[model samples]
Target chain A: MYTSLFYKEWIKTRRPLLLLSAVFAATVAYILLNVAKLYQANPVALWEFIVQNNAAQAGYLKYLTLGAGIALALVQLAPEMQNKRLKLTLHLPLNESKIVGSILWFGIVALTGLYLASGAILLAGLTVYFPAEIVSANLLAMLPWMLGGLAAYLFAAWICLEPVWRQRVLYTIPALGCTSLFYLDALPGAYLPFVPWLASLTVAGFAFPFYSAIRFKQGVQ
Target chain B: MNAIIQCENITHYYGNRLIYENLNFEVMPGKILGLLGKNGTGKTTIINILTGFLKPRAGVCRIFGEAMERLTPAAKSRIGLLLEGHIQHTYFNIEQIEKFYSRFFPKWKREAYYELLKRLQVTSTQKISAMSCGQRSQVALGLLFAQDPDLLILDDFSMGLDPGYRRLFVEYLREYITAENKTVFLTSHIIQDMEQLIDDCIIMDYGRILLHEPAAHILNHFRRFRFTSDADEIAPADGTLWHTEKVGNNWETYSFASAADVQRTLADGGAAVSGLAEERLSLEDAFIGLTGKY
Candidate 1:
């Protein structure tokens, strides 16, 4: 059952997913090439700037990943809400909760995979010249952003599955607040201390979609 | 035969406005029960409740002897629903939707779905969103048949279809219902389409069931009688007379029993009647008379 659902979601998301991946790869390559150019022009100055100034060249990834995650969730869920096709989905023979969980899980898997791939691209590009510790620090700084991406997907699911506009606006208040927490500061390794708690909170947000589904079933709108 | 779908004292409200109150009915096994009502009479609300999409404020609905709100997955598997306007997962192509649904139903009839699809202009790769409303309706109908459900609840199957498509839909449904002998509960404003299709009907008005009877019985027994009477004369308090209206000097009464029964009712009420002739009515006329305009 989940296999079929995954295939269904894959069909819906394959185009956007490929496009996003291409864009991520291109962006990483561009950033790496620019860094390389700077290094070749003035290697000593670049090294001093990086070491003394704590320049986070990879900071662009924070919002980029979050945007990708939000777009991905919208691509997956907006149609279901717009035309009320979720009603057809909920009528299927599977347990309603299981059906919802499966769809959300598929979106999570795809979003998480894309985030990880983007991270790998950035890591590989930076590791060519940067020291191992700098590369590791840059990657660690991305933790909150990665967590933000997942939370954006979950919150988008919550917002889209929500039937009433008034309640959706109310939900957005907290959703915006939650998403903003990940971008507090781009300092390298700043989010490391809160990593465990942030991850726990992101995982717990999955339950919000189920609550929306229940309200939808009850004809809340 | 036992009841397959039953609702007792099903009352519901949306905010301060009551949608329906103390509504009650049942669809017996192997019966096609058509729910007829004017717009805003809570037909769709009842459908939503029956499908477990809405919880009524006051009553219980049972399908296959299990409460609707608590229907198990196994129970849901036995019911097929064609949603209003033939809503579906419009992103998927025909082949994709077939594969997705076939996995859920153990008795999925792939051939049945494909056979129905063959009659349409849609190709296997066509997305449902790309198709016209008529073609989409066909796809929705095909998927419902493929599920092989024991009880089919069609909520306004003829909503957007042209007359040709509506006739085709009813014909195909007739053939399937005869072959499978499954129970059906449906709602439609197109009374003519249902005239030849439904076995029993429940007509609703103002949150109450106005009439419930076999189609043949309703046609044979329910009659419209027109006669000249005093403007101030009131209609008889007869339970069999569903409605009465005064137009000019002519009084028209919609009776649920027979012509003689209505005459006896008028005489008993002591209202002097003249030219008490029965008027022939089609199902649509009867529906309008029973529910009234506006």
Candidate 2:
């Protein structure tokens, strides 16, 4: 049952997943090429600037990661919302929670995988031109952005699964408010001290979709 | 025999407006029951309640002896649901959908699904989203057939089909139900199609169930009566008559009473009647007669 559920999710989401992967790969490559140009101009100056300013060269990644989360959520969940098609999923001969869980689980796992690959590529590219301190600072800066992506994905699911428009609007407020915390400062390691809080917020966001699913099942209008 | 589906005193409201109150009905085993109602009379509401999508304000609905709101996965396996407009997961192609659903049911009839698809004349790789509404309906029906469920709950199955597809659906469903003796509870705006399919019916009015009986009984017993009367105003003295109206000197009404009883009741109401006639009605005519044209 779980395999079939994932298979159905995969069918609905594979196209968007592929499209997002290509875009993310292209964006990461572009970021790496920019950093390489800076290193070629003056490697010593680039290293000193990075060490002194504590900045991650890849600022474009912030919105790319966030946009990927939002886009993936919309593609994965908006179809289910159309024509109340989620009823088909709920009607399957399985536990309703398990069905809902498997759907969210698939999106979360897919997003996590994409984020991991993109982050790994970014880190590996930086390692070739910079020392450990610069790479570690980049990693620290990127972690919160990835957590923000996860939070955005889950929040989008909550809003999309919500059956009523008024409630969905209300949900969007917190969705925006909460995800904005990850972008308060762009400098490398700026959010490192608050990483645990940001991660906690992302973890808590997973529960919101289940609440929306419950309302949907109750036929709230 | 236990009822295949039962609703006891089901009451529900939309915010402050009452959709229905203390509504009750049951579908007996092997009986094909149709829920007939004018729009906004809570037909879909009942379907939602029965399927555990909408929790009612009061009362309980049980399917296969389990509460609908808490149906076990085993219980759900025995039921097939067709939503309004024959909605399905349109993202998957014909074959992919079949493969996706086949894993859930132990008694999945893959041949049954493909057999119906062959009639659609579409390739297995064609996505359901690309099909016309009628074609989508057939796919939904084909999926239901493949599930091989014991109970089928269909909501407004005739909403978006041409006559040919509607006839095909009704005929195919009739044959399947008869051959398998499956219990079906369904509603359709097209009462003529339902007339041919339903063995029993529950006609609903605003906030209540107006009538619940076998379709054969309703057709054989209930009738429309038209008579020309000399009196200026004729009215039924009792509640037996439904939707009594006067057009010129001609009076028409629907009732379950016999011709003799109707004549007596009119005479008692002080009408001098002539050219009294009884009209045997189709289910659609009977429905309008019972519920009125308004």
Candidate 3:
């Protein structure tokens, strides 16, 4: 039954998933090509640039990482919500949480795998670019960013279903609040990289599969 | 025979309006139990409650003698439900669904699915998104019967089906009930389609079980009664009777429970009780007679 569920997921999700995988491969290749072009042209200047802008570079990567999470939520989970096909799985004999969880986790794994493959290619290009550049062992040692993208997507999907049009305003409230806190410089340092909305998405990435699963088990009338 | 499905006083409320109140009924095993009501009479609500889809506001329902909320996998495995519309993922083709369902339903017979597919004219390779409404309905039925459940619950049956498919469906349903002798709990406003197959019926109107009995018994007892003058209007059993409007100058009252009791009441009311006969009732007529207010 579990395999069947996963198979169903693969059949339904294959197109978007394939397109994303292709995107991952292409983007990584381009990044590697750019790194090689700069390294061979001016090795001294490229090494100095890396040392000077390491934080900015990491920040940019973090932003890109966040984008990955966002894409995972929308691309993988949103369509199911909009189409209302989740009800079909919900009505089935399987546990609601388990089914949704499996789907969410499945997307997470796929996104992570494709992204890591791209990153590895990019890292090889970086190694060829400037061998003498100071590589931060500590920053590299930090844990992989938890892509709670699937979770957020599921949460947003759940919120999106409410019949009330005013419920949409709920999105703006969080966005505005987050901006105000960031402007005030009150944002905590440890959680700086993982934005609240992203965190919610990540949380949704984890929690929604279970919660939605329970709701799914309730079945459709 | 033991009741395989029991609805123990299930009362549901939609905002301020009550749908069904203290609706008590039980469907015996291997019996075709039909639920008959007019549109919006809460038949679907009752069905949703039975399948554990929509939660009841007041009481619990039991399937195969166990509470539906606590339904075991083995219990759910034995019951098949086909809702009003097709419930499969449309993105998937018929072959994919057939393959997927083969894993989920333990009793799912692949040979039986294909057999029904052939008989029903459903192609396994047809995508659900591309199939016409009639074809989709067929696929749903095919999946349902393929599971070989002990209890089959069908809601709003014959909606999208063309005449040919309708005939085929009825024939198959009739055969299943008679040969396998499984319990069928079906609800539809189109009562005549399923009326012939039903041994028992549970009905609702104005948020109460207006009638619940064997189809023959309800037909035999609780008929249209004609009475002349105000002096002839007899009190019915605790106000359970319905008044069916005028025929010439006399008033007609339809009362349920016991014909003998109703006959005695008319006799005691000091009026002419000359017209006493069973009205040749269609399921439609019985529906209006019990539920309609004149």
Candidate 4:
């Protein structure tokens, strides 16, 4: 049964997942290509330039990662909400919580996988020109952005499953507030001390979708 | 016979407006029961309660001898549901959806589903979203049949179906019920399709059950009566009469009692039964008579 569910979701999400991954990878490659071209222009100035303006690089990636999270959540949940098709899955013999949890988890996994893949490629590409410290610093800076992506996915799922437009807007407020914390300071590795707690909290954001699914089953508005 | 479905004192409300109070009904084993009501009369509300989609404000509903809200996975496997508007996972095509649902049901009958699908002029590769409303309904029904459940609950099955499609769907359902002898609980405002299909019925009006009896019994005992009365006079308020509406000086009343009983009630009320005639009524007429034309 679990395999069937996974396969069903795979079919529905495969197109969007591929398209999103391609778009993200292209953005990362474009940024790195510019970085490499700058390094070729003046080796000494390139290193100094990146070290001083590292936060600007982080800013570019942060918004991209957040956008990816919102896209994944929309791709996974919007159709189910469209015609109240979620009721079809709720009618299955499986537990309601388990069904909704599985969907949220799947989105999280897919988002994390794509985010990590793009991040790794960019890291490896940068390593050829920059020192290990700079490369690792950039990776640390990207962690909070990825965390924001997961949080956004969960929050968007909650918003999509919510029946009332008013409640959905209410949910978005807290989600935006939570995500804003990750973007507060763009210093490379600034959130490193809090990564463990942030990761745990990001995972806990999944509970919102569960609550939404329950209210949906109850036909609440 | 065992009660496949039961609701006791099922009271529900939307905010402060009471939709129904102390509403009760049952679906006996192997019997097809139709919950008939006009728009906003709580037919769909009863269905939602039974399906555990909406928990009633008060009262309890049991399916297969267990509370619907807490039915176990095994208990759920014994039931089949066809939601309103014949909603399905439009993402998957015919073969893909069948394969997906086949794993969840222990008694999944692939051939049963395919056999029904064959009757439709749709390809196995056709996605449900692209199909017409009638085609999608057939697919939904086919999926339920493949599950081979002990009970079937269908809500507003005729929502967007054309006349020919509606008839086809009803015929297929009738054949399935007769062959399997499974219990069915359905709600439909469209009465003609359900007239010959339901073994028993519960008609609702003004948040109350107007009639609950075997179809044969309701047909035999309950009837419509028209009698002319003086303009200043009112019709008799007898317990047996379910609803009464007057057009000009002529009064039409629906009664659960026999024709003779109706005449006796009118005569006792000091209203002469001079033009009293028992009008033949189909189930649709009986529904409108019980729920009135609003």
Per-model RMSD to reference: 1.8, 1.4, 5.0, 1.8
Model 1 preserves the real interface contacts to a fraction of 0.73
DockQ sort, best first: 2, 1, 4, 3
> On residues B107-141, what C-alpha lDDT tens digit does candidate 2 reach at each position?
99999999998999799999999999999999999
Q: For candidate 1, lDDT tens digit of each residue in A128-188?
A: 8888988888788887888898998999899989989999999999999988988787478
Best by TM-score: 2
Q: How much of the real interface does each model capture, measured as fnat?
A: 0.73, 0.79, 0.46, 0.71
CAPRI docking class of candidate 3: acceptable
Compare candidates 2 and 3 on TM-score and give the better one.
Answer: 2
Candidate 4 lDDT over residue span B124-239, tens digit each: 99998899999999999999999999999999999999999899899999999999998999987689988969999988876789779887777776689888776346566667
Question: Top model by lDDT, which number?
Answer: 2
* Complex DockQ per candidate: 0.77, 0.86, 0.38, 0.76
Best by DockQ: 2
lDDT of 4 by residue, A1-221 (tens): 87887878898999989898888878888878878888889878776778677723444677888888888888888988887788778778898888898888788889889989989888888888777888888888888889988888888898999977899999999989988877667578778888887788797898888888888888785
The fnat score for candidate 2 comes to 0.79
Residues forming the 10-long window of minimal summed lDDT in candidate 2 chain A: A49-58
Ranking 1 against 4 by lDDT, winner: 1
Model 1 spans with C-alpha error above 4 angstroms: A48-53, B230-233, B267-270
Q: Name the runs in model 4 displaced over 4 angstroms.
A: A55-59, B229-232
By TM-score: ranked, best first: 2, 1, 4, 3
DockQ of 1: 0.77
